[model samples]
Target: MTAQRACGLSDLVQDEARRVEIDGVPMAVVLDSNGEVHAIGDTCTHGDISLSEGFVDGDSLECWAHGSAFSLRTGKPLNLPAYEPVPVYAVTLDGDDVLIDPSVTLDVN
Candidate 1:
């Protein structure tokens, strides 16, 4: 899979989400509290809101509109109003660069 540079490792703050678009696909890249990076579909499963605008709680990202929490690792919804899971992309780190493959979506079933 082709990996596109999303942002620098320093550009991401812990427990914050960043909105990015790669290959015309909207994505949400997050740096969790443990200093790990995660990439997922930006749209929330429950609504049309962007997940990047949501709050990051540990490994889960909570939708600001509906409070739907999704796992960063699997993209599975952990709360109500969102029964469907979003696509979780593959993230790689090359030194201080954060790369994401929009074409590769990890199976979260």
Candidate 2:
């Protein structure tokens, strides 16, 4: 897996979303309510709005532009206005650093 340094762990707190662009691909590194770090496509599938500007609850991410929610781990659409699943990247914690593999695709579907 190709890893990129997104941000430091201190930059992300529990239940928060942080926006970062890597290699021209915009993405969000979210710390869910479960305190897990998830990297997902920052753009909402239904629109051009940034999912990083949305709300984070557990493993679900809510799009602020349309209220559509997405699963952080699976990148699945969980509500109306969004039928396509966003792409999710893999995240690895290396000490205090946040390492993300933006090119990694989910094997499921």
Candidate 3:
């Protein structure tokens, strides 16, 4: 898989989400409350709003526009207004660098 550098680990704050674009695909990279990193499609499946602009509630990211909460790990919508799951990318930490592969989705079957 083609892994691209998303950002530095120091660039992210715990429990906050950041927007990053790799290969023209917008991604929402979040540092969860547990200090783990997750990467998901930035756009909300239920709306055109960016998930990066949303608030992080525990392991879920809530869409600011419609209040749809998406799981950080599976990219599945946890609450309604959104039924479809967003694409989740595989994240790799290379030293202090945060790398993401947009071509490799980590969603559960």
Candidate 4:
């Protein structure tokens, strides 16, 4: 599937994550302090919590339930309790829009 507009760029705050659903796929869209946008699976592997409801630190999104920090760049959890990595999606900036394709997940190493 092609990229679809997830949200407006101006709607995101730095170091914050916004929960968005594209084609029924739940994702957490974050705007880092460096002014870059990222999209990852919203569900925490350790728990059934929403990652968007968690905290954003540097390039990671921490699960509020068990403190499992997932890398915004690779979607890998940095601590225990979450062994599975979330899916990271490609973000496209178009003017004031943040575009993402739910069917396309980045193969981050």
Considering every candidate listed, which one attains the maximal lDDT? 4
Superposition-based RMSD of candidate 3 using all C-alpha atoms, in angstroms: 0.8
Error of 2 at 33 (Å): 2.1
In the predicted model 3, the residue pairs found to clash are: none
Instruction: List model 4 lDDT by residue over 2-109, tens digit each.
Output: 999999999999999999999999999999999999999999999899999999999999999999999999999999889999999999999999999999999998
lDDT of 1 by residue, 1-109 (tens): 5999999999998999999999899999999888889999999999999999999999999999999999999999998999999999999999999999899999868
TM-scores for every candidate against the unseen true structure? 0.96, 0.94, 0.97, 0.98
Best-fitting candidate, measured by TM-score?
4
How many clashes in each structure? 0, 0, 0, 0
lDDT of 1 at 107: 86
The ten-residue window of minimal lDDT in model 3 covers 100-109
Cα displacement (angstroms), candidate 4, residue 54, comes to 0.4
lDDT of 2 by residue, 1-109 (tens): 4888999988997887899988888998997776689999999999999999999978888999999999998999999999999998888899888988777766546
Model 4: CA > 4 A from native: none
Model 2 lDDT at residue 56? 91
The lDDT of each candidate is 0.94, 0.88, 0.93, 0.97
lDDT of model 2 at position 72: 91
List where candidate 2 sits over 4 angstroms from the true fold: none
